[model samples]
Target: MYKHLVVAVDGSATSLNALQHACSLAEMSNAKITLVHVANPSEYMAMAPEFMHHASYEEAAVAQGNEVLDFAEKAVQEAGLSDVVKHLLVANKGARDMAQELVDYADEQGAELLVLGTHGRSGLMHLLMGSFAETVMRQSHLPLLVIRSQKDEDE
Candidate 1:
């Protein structure tokens, strides 16, 4: 019953797995798929002024995000799904919480389901890196499907 599906990708293997799963689900349900990549404002701000000589950090991030989306879109196309939308979101509104931005975008796009992958990092690593999927799962009211980490296959 998924009408609109949103998949968050960041070019990682885990994210790619999620994308593949989302594509399959979209095909089965005849759902329109939206792929989104969020760039943190803090990362842009962290760039020194010298780093912006040729292009602004925001522009660079968007370019990279587009590349990620492009790869994901190609995968969906290869899977025979033509209805795909892509968003390269740069988080610049006040706080730079990516999970919030993803949830906000999904809500704005009226996505019936949101899919993402977990890296499965726990303990201190999880504390330092934080878990995007976990944060989104905690905050999002929409239906979420989390693809476990590739490492999970080994375990």
Candidate 2:
């Protein structure tokens, strides 16, 4: 049984599904769930080329972190996960990747399990943007539960 379940939510349907999965697993194991949202620095850099500007992508990411954390907290509450905590991870500061940041967070929090949602993007989309779910799987040392979209699972 997992003592601590770590869940990453990105505001996608797949992320929501992952949240649900985490809640279920927590309920089953009688464990605590920690919800995290990684604010991708690359995403912000891509959005605004002026990386030094205070109003640039970097600053935006820090602020967005709170928003994503709030969403995750709402999700946990809505899922009726009583023993859950929401965590906001700011990954823009010297972090290699969003996934790496999440893995470190889990370690810092002493979480035993990691859960993620897959977008199932392939080809150009996947090549250009990269995949958070894949990154998490590769970097995490703990047990991982990846929930793909319904259509992808069906296929």
| Predicted model with the maximum lDDT | 1
Model 2, 1-155: lDDT tens per residue?
Answer: 89899888877778888888888888888899888887765566655455454565657776777677788787777877778787777675443467888999999999998998887879998888677778778888888899987775525
lDDT of 2 at 83: 82
Give per-model TM-scores.
Answer: 0.88, 0.81
Regions of model 1 farther than 4 Å from truth: 44-54, 93-96, 152-155
Q: Give lDDT tens digits, candidate 1, residues 5-124.
A: 999998888899999999989989999999999975456766778776436667777877888999999999999999999998778653237888999999999999999988888899
Cα lDDT of model 1 overall? 0.87
Q: After superposition, how far is residue 66 of candidate 2 from its true place, in Å?
A: 1.6
Global CA lDDT of candidate 2, please?
Answer: 0.79
Residue 26 CA displacement from its true place in model 1, Å: 0.7
